[model samples]
Target chain A: MSNKKNALWHLPLIIIGIIALLPVIFMISNSFKTLQESYQSILSVIPNKPTIDNYTTLNHQVNLVRLVWNTFFMATLVTVGKLFTGLLAAYAFRYYQFKHKNLIYLLFVATIFVPFTIVMIPNYLVIAKLNLLNSVIGVALPQLCDATGIMIFLKTMEKIPGSLFDSLKIDNIPNRRIFFNIVLPILKPSIISVGAMFFINSWNEYVWPTLILKDKSSFTLPLALQNYISSEGGTNFPLAMALSSIMIVVPLIIYLIFQRYILNSISNSGLK
Target chain B: MHNNKKILPFLYLMPTGILLTIFMIIPIIYTFYLSFFDWNLIAPTKDFVGMRNYIEVFTDPVNQKVLMNTFFYIILLLVLNFIVPYVISLVVKFFIKRMQGAYKIIFFIPSLFSLVVGAMIFSWLLNPVSGPVAFLFRESGFVLPNWTNSGGLAIIVICLITNWKVFGYNFILLLTGLGSIPKNIVDATTVDRIPKWRMIWNIVLPMNKSIAIYVLILTIVQGLQYVFTPINVITTGGPYYGSSNVLYHTYLNAFVLYKTGNASALAITTFLIFLVLLYLEIKFVEGRSRYE
Candidate 1:
């Protein structure tokens, strides 16, 4: 009976797995096809004559290296910044109690729900006033201190017993050492989880970057690709697919490297 | 030593308080201040709008429609967001424990694509002529709606694109929740001869309430902003402005129309709605946690 039930469950898993992978397979296959072949049939899973012309074209027009660099630089900066700030804040919230602690924590948590649109205009105003418009800093600034990251870190820190802190104090370890030498080591999974999330979010972020960085020189991968599409028109499906393939490939590599850490963090953080 | 130790906690907390106050708290207060003014990029003088913008936004038929459309999209996307991914996650969790990592990577790849890139790709796929979707319908002997141009279909297509982009992340989140369930509980249910479906329905789902609520809140909040890109790229909130959401409407007001005050008003309203929802969620979760 258990075997039959297990078999029934496995059937859906196999089917959904295929469905989940279908678009990616479709994308990669079409990326190598000529534009003519892409339109011949929507259901075409294999290219008739695969070519690298689409990739070559994208490489030339999109300035792929610079775009990738900008994306990586911005994503890394934002991720690191958010991690530091979030960790510090979480540490503070977890290990310390002060006036209006709960109230302040609630306020920070409240910002998580403040739609980016609501803050976009004012944030732009501030960025503009600071003369940071059209720069990577402008694009990465608002994301540097995420409320969700802080909350995740706080939750993770809460899991650590208070006795650890007391013991650290007894050993005459300073608060700074307690944070760095003890708290941070145990918070590694949470940091990895939050860092991966922030990295992916910053890497994939479009609207804010598009709005903030109007200069072509500072364009991230997504913005650069969008410009390529708008300028060239949407007829070059193969080229677009090639660019899409590159976009997916980069993050997929990161995710693969950090898959276990990411999963562990997600599960442990209670963020699921 | 005890008094000095008490002071250390405050010292530890001071940096975060300062940073939050300077960055987040101050900016939110500034947002409130900006919402009351009529200002533009090119203009030197700022006029005190005195609730005029809010009144105009509330009274405008277009704004009303956009508000309704925002709610409609949220409701529709929420259903897709929860149901499809939850079911897929449950199925994936049930089987393929050994190959779960590979399955997760495959599912999450789309979510890693930039929203603009995803939007552009889908926009191409949904192109009326010389597009794959159209060609497929033709081959299948079925009519294809002009997805990006047709009013109702455009929204549905956008929803589908969002579903494709987000379902993997949702699935991973659900999988994470499922992973945390103690194996002994499941073993007990099995040893008692309880049916698997009944066990999942009666046991697993109930145990994952916090995760479920977290996902729900994130989906609703994220879905509101998701409308911004598609509305910008594909329709520009067109076909008699059917696709105009609150976010898109605010974008149009500020960028296109140069009505900064009206845009700010719209933004304020959007912020308030989500804030209220979040407050209720926090209350609900906290209350439940206490009860448990």
Candidate 2:
């Protein structure tokens, strides 16, 4: 009887949780609906007649393929950049002892909390000076190093017994070789979660991309999606939904694939 | 061997060091330096204008409103994005033990999308004309006020949009923190027959306080950022600077209006204010987190 009562307690939370995802459901469902059907059945979740028309319209109108490809490229570049640099920084912090290492690592960690506003203008100027404005590389360049990825890796390394490294040290192996051969395999899961975080963050990043990405073809997913909303006079609901669905699809897939680790490791994983 | 040890570490650090210096460190210092200049982005000559921009930030009535709007964003975001999520995490963790994975994934779904996307979805759903909610209101015989036209309502609409994107991620974060508490300690509360509220207050909250404080500080510091995309997407800080916060205003001043000096001053001032807040949080909250 008591167990049954406890089961009943799940109802309110389940209802609220489903309710929370209403907009997500709405976005997905409406993406399949015709533009007329979308407004005709505003509250209806399931499209009266599912069609790929909206997506085709969106593709031709927004050059969706180019935007998706550019977004994918930028996001991947950032993920790779952050992972590579973050791994090296964390490895050095973990393995080799250097003077003021703790202070330096703390400084790296401190960068995690520096508000975006403080960096926005100056970084923009620097990127422009580099003649990279309105270029996809410009969007990817500034975010190439993430302090949070370093934090996540450091936390992951804390679990690997120090004896493993000590043995490698005794063998006179190069640190680079040991990092590639040993640390890479061991930190795979942490790397994946952190990489997914970087990818998804870059994918969903709006403000910085908004500033740098002025050219239509260069706009990342968020920038492209925002363009749809703002330029359409905010009334092109069906097209926006279709674009949003496309925008969210990558993160959605990432979430499903990494759900277990993403949930478990969010406390340690900070995405700036 | 000893020589290799020191040099190797520096070698490993160089790439990260270079990136951080360009992107984070120098930019911060540059912001402070620019705050003293009367320079436009396109202008050839730069004039030194020591602290005048900072004075303008304080005295300009428009900026005063921006500052006030920023405080409102901070307070409302704390409730929606921070406290509400914390409470929801507790409820889901404790009460909804069954299908916890379902709850976690479902709650976190909204967070998977961008704030710009969230803003777009919500502006439609809550639009006064031909919107689902507005239609419902009309059926009940009243017109819903158009939020985009009104300044206060615009701020609220943006906040709700941020909350939609932020709530689940924060819930998952707090849930993870709560999950780290040893099961035996939680079991002890049940065995003692402690009332639920008291157990939560006397035990659960104290134990989870450190991560909670981190999340709280994140809420305070990130509030403006979370609002940025939404405002930029839909409002443009409109109804005439009604919905703008410090960060957005800073971005606009520098990028949109070419007032680099004013923007830099605003940016540095905002940075220092947040730095002080973070210091206080570390001093007071983390200092007292004995469990940590």
Candidate 3:
């Protein structure tokens, strides 16, 4: 009876899991079809005659390589900038005693509560005023603050025994040296996990990039992909599908590789 | 000595302080300032509207529809995204011991993709002419309506897609919530000969209150904007404002309509509303914590 009960419970999960994967499976499978075949073979999972025409067409329509590079460039800059800011701020808040420290720390975390909409317009105006609009720097500069990471790092840092820091202080180690030699090594897991989260969020960002980037050449993959879909919808289903497939490549790879860290961080931070 | 110590921490804070003030603080102030002026994004100077835009946002029929749609969106999100996912997480935890990894990966893959891509993929699936669903239904002598063309259906579809891309995050959150429960408490219930369903209700649910509250507050705060991607990409908040939530409506006001004053006012109002909601949620959570 218990064995049967387990099977019964498992049945819905199996169904739901397959349902969840349908769009991904469809996207990959349909990308290989000709536009005509993609439209015609609507219900078919496998194409009768797979073709690479859509990808070639996509390459011709837009510089796929350049778009991917732009995306990588922006995501990398954001990751590095956020991690640097978060590291310094978290380290300062963790290790030092200073006037108004609690107040400053609260201010840092307070940004997390404010919706992006509150700042979206002014951010655009600032970027426009600075003449960074339609530039990659404009797209990246406003996003470098890492309130979420600092909060996570601060929490993680608090759990470490004070004796560890006290011993390092007893050795007369400077703050910078202690940060590099001791703190970083201990917080390696958090850095990796939080760093990956930052990278993924930056990479997948769309609305802000859409608001900032106007020139097609400056378009990140999500923006470019959105342009492709809106511009080419209904006519080239296969090409659109190809674009979708390519767009998720880096993020999918990152998630697969760092999933353990990512999941660990999510569980750790979210539950607490 | 005190001054010297203060200098180091301040230096450590400089980067974040500079960036956030420029990006977050200054812009927020600017948004508030802009809310008073009618800036169409063209003229050399903005016209001082002096609460005119706020009055329009409150009195306009289109804004009324937006308010309703936002309410509906939040309700659907709570039901589909929060409650359903929480239940699914519980079910997954209770059953299916072996294939947990597979289930999580599959659910999570969509979230890794940008919302734009996810919207496009689903758009293709729901396409009336060449979509798989259409084709399947057409084969059975039934036709699938253009899902994005209908206002009500579009909102529902957008909410469903939002849940699809999002539920994985909440699932992981709840999974961890369940994981963090004391093993001894669970074992005690089992030894007490409690039925699984009874144990889940009487013990598990109550124990997971904080995480549930966390999820609830997040949904309330984010639910308005969560539908933006799908509404923008799929329907463009169309079918006569049926699918337009306040966030998307705000986006249209500033970007599409160039009504910067209206958008800013709308944004500020939305922020203030959410701030109150957040405060109340914290108060309730804190109140509950006192009992613990």
Candidate 4:
């Protein structure tokens, strides 16, 4: 009776797993097809005559290497900035008490809900006025002080014992010194977690980059790929699929490299 | 010493506080302010148009349809986001008890991809003429539905794509919640001969209520933003405005029509809806916490 029940429970999961993987398999197979062949039979899992022309054309049309560099540059800068600023803020909030601290923290977390759409117009105006438009910094600046980063950092910092601060005080260390030397080492996991989140968010960003970045030279991977598709005309389904395959592959590589750390961070962040 | 310590915390928090105030709070207030005026980026001067933009937006039939479409799409996405991830997490929990780490990495690959990229991939997969779905249907002797051409189906396709892209993150969250359950409690239930289904239904699901609510709130927030990308890409909210959602309509108003005031009005309305949903979520979570 127990065996029967367990088997029944496993059925739904097996079916769902196959369903979940179907599209990914379809995407990979479709990427290899010729334009005519792809259009001839949209659902063909195996191309009748598989060709590498789609990838070759994608490479020629868009500088894949440059686009990857642009994306990496922005994501890395934003991730590093958030880690630095967020750690500083988190350490201060965790170790010290001040007037209106709660109120200030409240206001900071509240800003998380402020949608990007509300500020896109003004942000554009500010970036243009500063002559920062079409620059990577212009794209990176708005993301530097993310409230979610602060919240995650502070939450992690709160878990450290007060005794650690007292011991540092006994060692005649200043708060800033203690934060940099001791507290930071202990907060590595949180840093990794928040860094991964920030990197992923920055990497996947499109609307801001699309609005602020006008030069094709400055386009990140997503924007470059979008331009490739729209300009090439959307009918070049195989070429579009090829570019997308490249786009998807880069992030998967990064995530796989840091897969354990990223998952550990997500689970630890208590975001669930 | 106490006074100095107290002041230090304020100094540390000042940077974040001031930045949020200027960038976040001010922009929100300015969105409201902009909504009441007929201002354009090209125009030198602004005319104060009190309630006119709101009136036009509320009265327009197209705006009404867009608003409905927005809510409809959000609802559809909410259901998919909840059900798909929950089922996926459960299956993942069953398969890899010891290899949970490896399973997580496999599932989370999709979430790391950019929305534009994911949409592009799905757009290819769903291509009616020579796409995978169309090919499958043709092979099976069934006609393929023109996903992009059909307004309602296009929205559903967008939601499914979004679900596929992001569900792994949520699944990981649920898996973590499941992992945190005390072993002793599970062992006791098992010894009592409580069936796996009964144990999950009565024990595990109830224990993870908070996590479920968190997922729900996050899903709603994400669902709103999903409109921005899909609208920009696939349909541009088209087929005679069949797919035009509230956010897309606002984009059209500001960028295409150059009606800043009307766009701001639509933005404010959307923000209010989000605000209400957020507040309700907070209250619900807080209430549950107290009970727990």
TM-score of each: 0.91, 0.95, 0.94, 0.90
- Candidate 2 on A177-198: residue-level lDDT in tens? 8878888988988888888878
Better of 1 and 4 by lDDT: 1
Ranking by TM-score: 2, 3, 1, 4
Which residue segments of model 4 deviate by more than 4 Å? Answer: A1-56, B1-3, B90-102, B195-198, B284-292
Two-chain DockQ for each candidate model: 0.51, 0.58, 0.59, 0.44
Clashes of 1: 0
On a 0 to 100 scale, what is the lDDT of residue B72 in model 3?
Answer: 85
Candidate 3 segments exceeding 4 Å error = A99-103, A232-234, B141-143, B284-292
What are the clashing pairs of model 2? none
**Of the pair 2 and 4, which is ahead by DockQ?**
2
| Residues A1-272, model 3: lDDT tens digits | 87888788888777777767787888888899977777677557888898888888888988888998888889989999998999899888887777777667656745756777888888888899999888878989998877778867877888878788888777877777888887788788888988888888888888888899999899988887777666755467777888888887888888889888888787766645
Ranking by DockQ: 3, 2, 1, 4
Local accuracy of candidate 1 as per-residue lDDT tens digits, B80-158: 8877788778777764445677778777767766777667767777677866777779989986777666667788878
Give DockQ: model 4: 0.44
Instruction: Output the worst ten-in-a-row residue range by lDDT, candidate 3 chain B.
Output: B283-292
lDDT string for model 4 (B44-121, tens) is 888998999899878988888888888888788778887677766765664334445555666676777777876777
**Candidate 1's chain A scores what TM-score?**
0.92
> Which stretches of model 2 miss by more than 4 angstroms?
A1-8, A232-234, A270-272, B280-292
Q: Which residue pairs show collisions in model 4?
A: A39-B130, A42-B130, A42-B131, A42-B132, A43-B131, A43-B132, A43-B135
Cα RMSDs, all models = 2.9, 2.6, 2.5, 3.2
lDDT of 4 at A217: 83
Global local distance difference test of model 3 = 0.81
